[model samples]
Target: MWHIYQFPLCPFSRKVRLLMAEKGIAYELQSARPWEGEDRFFAMNPAGCTPVIKDPDRNIVLSDSRAICEYFEETVDRNPQISGTAQQRAEIRRLVAMFDENFFRDVSGPLLHERMKKRLVLRQSPDAKALREAMKLAHDYLDYVDWLIDNRPWLAGSTMSLADLTAAAQISVADYLGGIDWTTHEQARAWYLVMKSRPSFQPLLSERMEVIQPPSHYAEVDA
Candidate 1:
């Protein structure tokens, strides 16, 4: 059996979980809090990150979402998320990087730090200024998604890929944090609704992170 060490709301972990579910890979969740700095967790992964996957039978221990995803991509022949021609694969990676790095930096990371980390981990009040900044940047990111939806079926190109999973993971977290405002983003909202309606997304929507809760619309597929 494969076991994944991850937190409920970690977007990168969510990305891996989505990919695993979409690809029909079986894995059990082993909840972890990297921020807590547990000795066992650090011993398993020196970097101390969530989304670590271990296969005891195979003696395989993998950390880092990208590395884990790519490992499965190479090992599994079916349900290729990074499929198609060389150019198409490149496009997928490009968009994946854009969401994983830029979007996280500008939106999801800040919201997580303010709304989740501050409240749960730090036991401190969220800074209104930082919260406002994250929400404002979320609009910008969603605006870009709206434009992308206008141009392509998915973020990268025609078929669903890692790009979709990555963006959906980030957006789901941001939306959960109430950092997203989909009121004016019709196209983006429609795109995300499709994502939310997927079978792989259902578990994520239903799961909670301790005391904090998402907005009512967060789990509603039609919303």
Candidate 2:
């Protein structure tokens, strides 16, 4: 069996998990918290990141989530067209990059590091300045998503792709922490509702932190 080294809450890890579930691939989940500095974790991934995949053959040690997703797409039998044709693949890559870069940097990263600090049980107090900055950045990011959803059902295009999963994973974390104000971005909110309703998304919605409870409508598909 393939062994997936992951933390339940990490967005990147969540993306890989979602893909695995979508493809109906059975794998063993090895819980590893990179923040704790495990030697084995470091051995698997020098960067000490979560979501590393260890193939049973021990020949392939995949680190990056995108690379792992691509690997699975190429090697697996079901739904092997995650990237589609060369042109479509390029677009998927671009949107996946956007989610990892722009969305994570300007939205989820700050929300977790700032607004959700209290819930995450950090040693430091919530930084008001950082919270304000993150809120502004998140709102702007949502505005862009709003525009995208207005034009297309998915972030990259019509069909559900890795791009949607990547963005959904990050946004789901924020939503879990109650960091989003969905009322402000109706289009984005609607799109998210659809994604959140998927069976693949159920695991994320049910995920609970020690101190954090998801919003009341989190488990509601039509909410």
Candidate 3:
């Protein structure tokens, strides 16, 4: 069985888990915190990142969320998340990068540092100003999502793709940290509800991080 080294709240790991579940790939979770700087995890991934997958039976090791997902997309061949015409695939990849890099940089990363890392590791209270700034950026990102939903059935195109999963992954983390306000973004909220109700998303919603708790609406699919 493939063993995934990840913590409960790592969005990148969550994205990989979602793809694996959608593709019916079986995996066992081995909770890891890269911030602790464990030598074993670093050996698997010199970058000291979570979401490293290893198959001891085959002695295969892989790291990096996008690379791991693409590896499965190529090897598993059951559910194709990056499928479509070449142009369509390009669009999907573009959106994935936007969510994974840009969205994380502006929204998810800040919330994680202020809300999660600060409270859990640094023993420091969250910065109200930083949290407010991140939440405001979230609104802008959600407005963009609203526009996308108004144009296409899904983020990238007519059907669901990695773009949708990638965006949802970041949003899920942000939401868990109480950084998301669904008010005034009806289209985006509706689309996110659909994502939350998916089978692959249920497990993620139910899992909890160490001490921090999500807002009440975080796990409620209809809320």
Per lDDT, the best of the predicted structures is: 3
Better of 1 and 2 by TM-score: 1
TM-score of model 1 vs. true structure = 0.97
Q: Could you estimate the TM-score for every candidate?
A: 0.97, 0.90, 0.98
In order, candidate lDDTs are: 0.91, 0.79, 0.94
Error of 3 at 4 (Å): 0.7
Winner by TM-score between candidate 3 and candidate 2? 3
1 versus 3: better lDDT goes to: 3
The TM-score leader among the candidates is 3
Once fitted onto the true fold, the runs of candidate 2 whose alpha carbons sit more than 4 angstroms away are 57-59, 115-122
In order of listing, the candidates' clash counts read 0, 0, 0
> Following a full C-alpha superposition, what root-mean-square deviation does model 3 have from the true structure?
0.7
Q: What are the clashing pairs of model 1? A: none
Q: Candidate 1 or 3, higher TM-score?
A: 3
Candidate 1 per-residue lDDT, tens place, 1-223, comes to 8899998889999999999998899999998999999999998899898888999999988998888888888988778889899999999888888888999999999999999999988999999999999999889889998999999998888988999999999999999998998999999999999999999999999999999999999999986
